[model samples]
Target chain A: MKKYTNTGSKDTRSGFGAGMTELGQKNENVVALCADLIGSLKFDEFKKNHPERFFQVGIAEANMIGIAAGLTIGGKIPFTGTFANFSTGRVYDQIRQSVAYSDKNVKICASHAGLTLGEDGATHQILEDIGLMKMLPGMTVINTCDYNQTKAATLALADHHGPAYLRFGRPVVPNFTPADEPFVIGKAIMLNEGTDVTIIATGHLVWEALLAAEALEAKGISAEVINIHTIKPLDDTAILKSVAKTGCVVTAEEHNFLGGLGESVARVLALNNPKPQEFVAVNDSFGESGTPEQLMEKYKLNNQAIVEAVERVIKRK
Target chain B: MSNTQQLQDFSTQVRRDILRMVHAVNSGHPGGSLGCTEFFTALYQQLLERKPGFNMDGIGEDLFFLSNGHISPVFYSVLARSGYFPVAELATFRKLNSRLQGHPTTHDGLPGVRMASGSLGQGMSVAIGAAQAKKLNGDKHLIYSLHGDGELQEGQNWEAIMYASAKKIDNLIATIDLNGQQIDGSTDDVLNLGNLKTKFEAFDWDVLEIKEGNNIDAIIKGMTEAKSRTGKGKPVCVLLHTVMGNGVDFMMHTHAWHGKAPNNEQLAVGLAQNAETLGDY
Candidate 1:
């Protein structure tokens, strides 16, 4: 097994801010719009650097979405920033009619995703965003795991045409991915290779999967860990190849199991390779106010949960 | 022929196209289409300074967006007649594999359509955004959009309405088709949009009214004045008060033909009412 080190701990939202700051200098056509959450979304540096390019849309997300779609008409790549809930559910029809259906180049950057959003409670934390975005035709859905990856994905989306949804969290996590690595929209990263079980994870759950692999290695069991950053146009080849070697799979994500990364992986497995699978995700329910650690522990989304799921799936295989 | 007479002839021909397109499909909104024929005709034929061909990135030229896209018959007619596409293609309106979908969309690579609208209250924001883009590009061309008065009930319209004035998007001229009727009933019965001039003025927009909305001459005069109001630190709004159906006497003064296609007898009546001066497609 290969070892990876955490360079440091940083919140993914700040990484988005970092990426926007770089893009402000690099691409003149890259414009940013925020709905009165400039500080929460960490868009201060980008706003300060490119005061002309940054648009403060004041609390109107629907209008923000419409304006972003229109901005694409005159060769401007508009990046809209808001919470995950406001980004997806609040303005779905606007996205459907303007951006996706019209096939405009707009990047919808969402922060404070999933249960890791912590004390803001169920209203702010959105878990169904991936599903809503993926269902739209011609929409690229990317959920970055760490700070470095989030920054890379933000830069990558500028070159990508059409509509996309880039999801990240508010909680700070280990920045494991390399800073200079080029971000691919649909490619999956192989974190660790093993034979006993395959553990596929996305978003914040990716680091947890790595920790679970280390724990399983200590117990004389080999576990393969794959990081699926892009949920839609999923890295199906990587998933199928790893599951072929392990014969059993465990899918993890910080989302509802009903319509999330786990279900997407399960569909792939069910279609081609029939294998025993376990899901490490939020069952059909809403999240409440709690610390990020407490929510992960209570919702069974940590490394311990993956370790137990691996043990159960291995036995079934 | 003089310019006003030619535009009136053009509008009469366009009114014929609206009736024929809807009558052929047996589905579509013809009331607003007939109602807005003069406005569309005057904008495309006289008011707008447009390029010869259509492109998505309409730089260095004026751009127009149809917010209440249910009136696509009139929009398609004006776009085709103005040489964006072949006027014969208007026969394929709402048919399968047709570039002309029920709602205007750029998805089919249709020229002259920058945004998909049938879902109301979205085009104003799109127009404002395009206007801002023009400002960013140093392109002084204007962005024009038309919406239904009933579409004002949507919350998103209010948001965009508030935003345009606040941002000082002076390069946009948004016109509201005050036909005073919607699908369910009259605008007054469904929802009273009280005092539109005051509402827009309070929102800090430059407001004007074309009382003779169905008249080609009045529409030209009003829109030309609306153009002069640009670059003055406020977005302009034109409240165009028109009848639901203008030329066809049977269809006028009511919301009956809002989305309903006319029968053969009524189609004959409508066609006879607006004598085709420019020939039918």
Candidate 2:
């Protein structure tokens, strides 16, 4: 079994802020727009450094999206920052018409996604953003797990041509991935090698999946852990190869069971290889106000949930 | 021929094309298209400082965006006649695999289209952004956009309007096609956009009005003056007062023809009213 260590705890939004600050220095064409969430989105440094390149759109998500799309006409790569709910659901039509349908090069960087948004509840925590963004043609969807990965993904998305959605969270989590790791779009990173069962995880759930594998190893069951950062253009080959080695799979994510990473993985499995699969996701219900730890524990999105899912799926296999 | 006569001939031909193109598919918005024919023809022919060819990044040339894209007939005609595409391709309007979509979109690699706009209240922000981009790039070119009067009912327009003035984006000129009609009924009956001149002025924008938007001479004069107002630390808004359906008598002054296509008999009548100055595509 391979062991992973947490370097320190840092919020993923900080990684985004760090990445954006670097982009401002490196790329002159990189412009940033925020809909009155500069402090929440952690864009203080970038805005301070690149005042000319930054636009503070006041509480207008739709207008912000439209402006980002238009900036592309004159060869400007725009990154729009906001909460996931306002970033996806609130301005879906604007994104669809101007950015996705027109194929504008805009990076929709969303923070505070899923139940982990904490205390803000269902209205602010958006679990269906991945599904909404992935459904748009030519849209690349990436949900990075930790601080290092989120920062790398932000820098990587600046080079991508079409519209992209980069999702992160508000809570501080384990900074596990390498600080200088090259983030690859649509490519899965293998965390551990095992044959007993495969645990595929994304976003904040990825760190939990690693811990779950260690627990499963203690129980004399070898669990393979794979971190899927990019939800759209899903690495089917990696998923299939892992599933082929281990007949059953446990898919985990901090999102709704209906339209998140689990369903995407299920579609791939059902199309290619029909196998025993168990989903560790929020079962089609809205979230309530609570701390990040309480919500993750209550929603069964912790390492224990993955362990139970692995046990149940192993029996089915 | 004189510039005004040449532009008038082009406007007549564009009106002819708008009527025929919408009639061919038995679907499209011809009322506003007809209403804005003169504005489109005049802008493309005499108003803009445009390059010869089309490119996605219009860095050095004046850019035009159609915010009220349902009236794509006039826009498509003017773009084709201005050498953006083949005039013969006007037959493909609203057809599958055609670059000329029902509403203008850049999805099909349409040359003149920079962004897709069918849903209302989005074009203003895009134009403002492009104008800002021009400033950022040190490219001294203006951005122009057209919108329907009723589209102002959408709240997003006000947001963009407020942002434009606060940011002091002086390189954009957004025109409103004040035809006084929407899909359902008159703008007064539908939403009542109370005193657009006052509203724009209150928003700290430089406001101008053209009482005769259907007249090519009036549009030319209004747009030329609007052009002079640019680079003066305020975004300009031109409120163009036009009849709903300008040239075609039966369709004029009514919202009934907003999105409905003219029948075979109505098409002939409409075409007869617009003289074939440069010949139809």
Candidate 3:
């Protein structure tokens, strides 16, 4: 079995902030807009360094999205920052009409996603943003796993010419990925290779998948772990090759079971390999106010849950 | 021909195109299109500082966005007649695989459209963003947008309105087609947008009223004055009071033709009222 180590603990939002600060200095055409959450989105350095490039849109999410779309007209790359819930749900029509349908070069960077948003509860934590964003035609949906991956993804999307949604979380987690690893859109990263079962994880659950691989290896069960950051253009080649070798798969995400990574993987398998698959995702339910650790444990979104799902899927295979 | 006569002739041809295109399809909004025919003609013909050919960036030239996009017939006609696309392509309006979408959209790579704006109350924000980009680039050009009076009911407009004034986006001229009618009924009966001029003034905007919006000379004068008000401290708003379905005696003065197409006989009546001067597509 292969082993992984956490370099440190860091929040993905800070990675975004670091990336934005770098972009402010590097790309003259890059601009940022915040809908009354500049501090929460960690945009202090960018705002201070490039005041002319920042727009404070004051609590209006719809206007922010529209303004971002419009800024793309004269060759300016606009990045909009807000909570995940407000970014996807509140201004869906604005995104649909002005950004997605029009094919504008706007990057919608959403933070505080899923139950890991902690005590702010379901109203603030958004679990359906991935599905909502991926449904738009030509939209690139990316959910990074750690601080290093998030920063790399932010820097990479500046050169990508199209509407994209980059989803991240608020809570700090294990910073395992390498600092200089170049983030590639729509490419899955293979963490460990084994022959028993394939564990495809994304977002916060990626760290848990690594832990599950170690635990499964202790029980004399070999596991293959893969991190799928981009959900829209799913890396079907990697998933099919892993599932073809393992004969079964377990998909994990910090989202609902329906219309998420699980469903996407299920479709790919059902269409190609037809392997036995299990889902480690939230059922049809909303999250409540709880600490980040409490919510992860209560929702069965930990390493133990992934191990159990892998075992169940291996049995089916 | 004089400048006003030339524009009036072009506007008459635009009205003919609107009536014929809607009548051919048997579905479209001709009421607001006819009402704003003169405004469209003047803006595209004489007002806008346009480049020779179509370009999407529009950095050095003026840009216009149609917020109330149901009135696409007039917009499409003027865009085609002004050489954005082939005038003969007006026959493909609302057809499958046509760049002329039911509303103005950039999805099909339409030459003139910058954003999709069938959904109301979004154009002002987009225009402001473009205006801000012009400011950032020191382009010294202006951004223009048109909306319906009824579109102000959407809350997003207020957000954009407040942002434009607060940001001092003076290089934008947002016009409202105050035709006093929507798909439902009169604006007064449905939801009265009380005292729009005063409302705009309270929001710290430079507001002007074009009482004879359907008149070619009046629109030209009003739009010229609106352009003069730019580059100061606030955005400019031109409240154009036009009769719904203007230029056609039968369709005028009512909301009945708001979204309804003209029948064959009705099309003949409308075409008779506005004789073609620049020829039809």
TM-score of each: 0.99, 0.99, 0.99
Docking class of 2: high
Candidate lDDT scores, in order, read 0.94, 0.93, 0.93
User: Over the stretch A190-299, how does candidate 3's per-residue lDDT look in tens digits?
Assistant: 99999999999999999999999999999999999999999979999999999999999999999988878999999999999999998898887899999999998898
lDDT of 2 by residue, A194-304 (tens): 999999999999999999999999999999999999999899999999999999999999888888899999999999998999999998888999999999999999999
Alpha-carbon RMSD to native, per candidate: 1.1, 1.0, 1.0
| CAPRI classification of candidate 1 | high
Interface RMSD of 3: 0.6
Among residues 3 or more apart in sequence or in different chains, the pairs in candidate 3 whose N, CA or C atoms overlap within 3 Å are none
The runs of at least 3 residues in candidate 1 whose Cα sits more than 4 Å from the true structure, single-residue gaps closed, are: none
Lowest lDDT 10-mer window, candidate 3 chain A?
A: A1-10
- Better-scoring candidate (DockQ), 1 or 3: 1
Give the C-alpha miss distance for residue B251 in model 3, angstroms. Answer: 0.8
